[model samples]
Every structure is written in structure tokens, then in C-alpha cells.
Target: MPRLPDDFDDDTDGFDPDHPLADQPALAAVARFARMLETIPWFSRVGDRLDADDRAAAEDYLSALGFPGAAVVPVGDWYEAADCAEALDMHSLSWEEEEHLRAVAHETALEITDEEALDVALSHVAHQAASLVGPAAVLSMRVGGLDDEALARAAAGYAVQACHQAALVLAAGLGAEHPFALKFRLYERGRWPVSITGESFNLF
Candidate 1:
């Protein structure tokens, strides 16, 4: 039998792996975000051309947040728990202050393009969004009482909408690997607010 790690997500809802899509939100977000990136000409053109220091900083931020490696741990594998973690990797941990700045620039600014010349840039955008899933899931699983699959589906929806809003606002291509639903949800629009049961971060 597999000795599952403590952090491994045992989906309370029992998401089926044969239909991985049933529980995989990050994959969907990546796809959808990638498509969004293709729609913007700016992001496509300026893809992945960051200066060394900036790139290092961005990589470190994500690494510190978490990424896969021998020393690094998997996000939603056999044994992981839902917790706010400080563990991060060296790739993106090179600098901490620039994390948000880098995410915003790669995701929302004129640097994002839809040009074929920036394939690597498009990939980076997807990677960044992908990085968010693990951390987001960790926060969500305990707070929202969800597993990776449910969190993923929710994140996909949220990410797509967020990216869409950002795209319309900035007029740039945002890369993602998984495509998301384009429909509007009443809850998200503030037309269907739910009653809070306790002290929480107010996850939907």
C-alpha cells in the first residue's frame, strides 16, 4: 500500500483521477490563462525578456512560495496538510519584496504580448499562475473545507475571471494553462452573497 504523506490530499469528495479534470483546478487555470495570453498582442511580444536581477527575484519569490525539486516538496501529492507555509524555494526566493511587483508586471503590464516571438514569456505567465495554485490550495483546503479538486475548480473560475478583468482593464494577453468558464456567477457579482457562519477569510 502507498504510505501517503500527511499532506497528500485525500479529497473528501473523492475526486476521480481517471477523470483528472474532475479535481484538477490548476491544470484548467493554466490552460485558460494560456488562452488568455494568446489574445493579447503585447504579452506575446515581450514574453520572458526580464533582466537577470528581476527574473531571479521573481523565481525566488515563487521558489520561496514553493516549486518541485528534491529538496522541495510537492504541493498536493500523497502527504501534505492545509496550512499557511513559509517554506519557499531558492529560484524565486532570491528577493521577497519584488514578488508582487513581478507577478503584476508579468501578468498585467505592457510586457505581456501575444506575439509568437515570446513563447517563453507566455510559458512564464502560465508558470506563475500555476505557482499560485499550490499556495492558494493550501490556504483554501482548511479555510473552505475543500480538497484539491474542488479548490482547483473554484480557483479556475476565479483565476479566469480575475485574468479576464485584468485583461480588459490592461488590454494585455495573460497566459494560463487551463481554460475557465466565461459565464458570470451571481455570487461573484455580489448579487448572491452568502451568510457567514464563523470567523473566516470569506472563501466562496
Candidate 2:
């Protein structure tokens, strides 16, 4: 499984070990405009090496980017609890779903003998594919009502325009096949609703 860095200095190539870059007046102004593109190992050889904090960061960043129901976490032999969600304009996920995803990832570790440990790592990728972006405000099973328009198909992710650009970046990284990617790729197509404060966004 992928482990999240305690610090973000692992790859200084301007790569987001956590989430995608947003149009921030500063990191604060851009708090809810971030986007995270999950990789698919089934399609290629990507989606590994991240931790819970990384997940939290990704979620927080995605929320900042206006993604509904986005959650971030750190991957490890065991996943860690993310602490920067509120500051990033996001909320934390529920322990149940968090535990569930970790367990699912860990169970799949048997096939990864050639590689190091990979349950939490694989979960990060799978969780994204199985996850519902607009379905809750945070970790809730409820749809956050985020529409496809926010995804910006013209950008990175799924939409028609992003297929070759953003999607390719993930394809080459996780080393998964295109079909596998299609399952989890986020769509930024149409319009949607907005979320208010004091809401609990947990995934079932």
C-alpha cells in the first residue's frame, strides 16, 4: 500500500502527493478549488504509496476545489487520521468507512508479494473508484449534490476533453488499463447543487 508522507518534500517536482493544485489567491483563497485524480492499478501500475494524511490532504484540497463528498486520508501499514481537513475547508470522514476501506485494501495484500505491503495503498485507488464524489458533504453516504459542471471535462479527470490530458497523467502513473480508469474517473460535465455548513458528510 502507498504511504502518505509526514511531510510533502518527497517529490519536489510540483507534484501533488496529496491533491491537485487549485486557483488560489493564495492556498487559503483557493481552499475549495482543488481536484484529486485517483490512479488505477488494474489499468496500469499506478495508485500506490500514499497515507491517510495524504488522503485527508487530497480530500481537503478537493473540497477546496469545490468537489462534493471528497475525503482525504493517509496510507500506511495502517492508515493514519488526517488532521488538516478543517483548515483546508473540508471535513473528516467517519471511522467506520475509513476502517472499512483500510480493511478492504489490507485484504488484497496477498497478490502483492513481489511488491511491499499494499492494502491501504490499493484502497486509496479503489476507494476513489468506488467512492461517490458528490454524494455527501464529507464522508456521509448522502450525495453532496455536486454537479458535473464543477469537474470541467475540459480539464483533468474524465470529461471528453480531459480524457487524453489529465487522464493520461494518471494512466501512466498507476499503470492501470483505460477501462479500469473509466470506472473511477470523475466527470466534470454538467451543473449541480451547493453544500452548506453544519452538515455531516460520511460514506456508508
Candidate 3:
């Protein structure tokens, strides 16, 4: 099972808003957005083909959260690697590929946390990163580019960093001390979480 940081107080049953680590601006923004999302039933609209009104409502929510001039677009579908691997004839990333991705993700994580609206930006970047991973892998496997290491590494990095940011955002919205929070901490240490069982995560 995943463990919290040694410094975390074990007595707390859930996220303590008053906790020092919970005082981040990013976390606060995400928490507020999460609450708003719940109120508006945003998650229910996720897979639906968003109509004009749905798009407007989403944009309005984002604008209120300090993202003006941003547009909300619908994705055709959402699937994790495990979900579509067989259909796509996909295999796990090679050891070298994994290393490149992890290294890049760690570096990107450090860079993104410094952004002004990290909570929002990170989520967007995470999606973009996920999109790139498949293409990058396919390209590397089919016709490796000359000196493609940089591109490959970058793709891998963004993918992992996306997972890290997502975990953090989810934890913030759920509660600062939720199991996802532990996942975030695990990512911070360059560890991968394989699964969630009840209140704990299975880490690798």
C-alpha cells in the first residue's frame, strides 16, 4: 500500500485545509473548480458530445477560474494504455523508452509547478502529453528518426508528468489527503503507481 510522507500527520482522517502543504494557490484553485464541477455535474458531461450551452458553461467556469480567452473542446474518446493496447497492437514501452519518459517527466514536473496557473495548465499539458506518447512510440518503432532521442525523451517526459499532475489535481479536488495524494508523492519520488485498492495504491 502507498504511504504518505513521513511528515504527514496520521491523525487526520482527510485533507486538512489548514495543513501547511494544503495552502498552495494551485490546490486552492483546483479545489474550488472541483467543487464547482461537482455542483454543475461536469463529470457527467465529459463523454457526451458537448453542445453550445455545455461548452459555454465550461468556458464560463474556466474564465471564472482565471482562464479567459480559453475554449472548451470535446474529445472524441478517452482511454488509458491498458484499455486500448490490444486494439492498437500496443506493447509496453521498452526499458530505454521508459527511462527517457521518466527523466523528461521529472524535469517537466519541476518546470510546470512554477507556472502561474499550474493547476489548470498542468491538466491541459497532461492531455497533450498523453496524445503524443502513442504517436512517438509508433514513430520510434517504425522508422526511428536520426537523433530522435530528444523527441522521444520529451514525449515520454510529458506523458509521465501528465500523470503526476493529474494525480495531484485529483487529490486536491477529492481532498488534499486522499489516496491520490499519496500517488502524487510517489510520482514526486519517481515511483510509478500500478493500481489503487481501496484506500491505498499499489506502487512500483
For all predicted structures, in order, the TM-scores are 0.26, 0.21, 0.25
CA lDDT of every candidate: 0.30, 0.26, 0.37
Rank candidates, TM-score, best first. Answer: 1, 3, 2
Give the lowest summed-lDDT range of ten residues in model 3: 37-46
Q: What digit string (tens of lDDT, one per residue) describes model 3 on residues 150-204?
A: 4345435533443544434433333333333423433333222232222221222
In the range 127-186, model 2's lDDT, one tens digit per residue, is 443343322212111133223332322112222222222222231232222221222232
**Candidate 1: C-alpha lDDT:** 0.30
Best by lDDT: 3
Candidate 1, run of 10 with poorest lDDT: 177-186
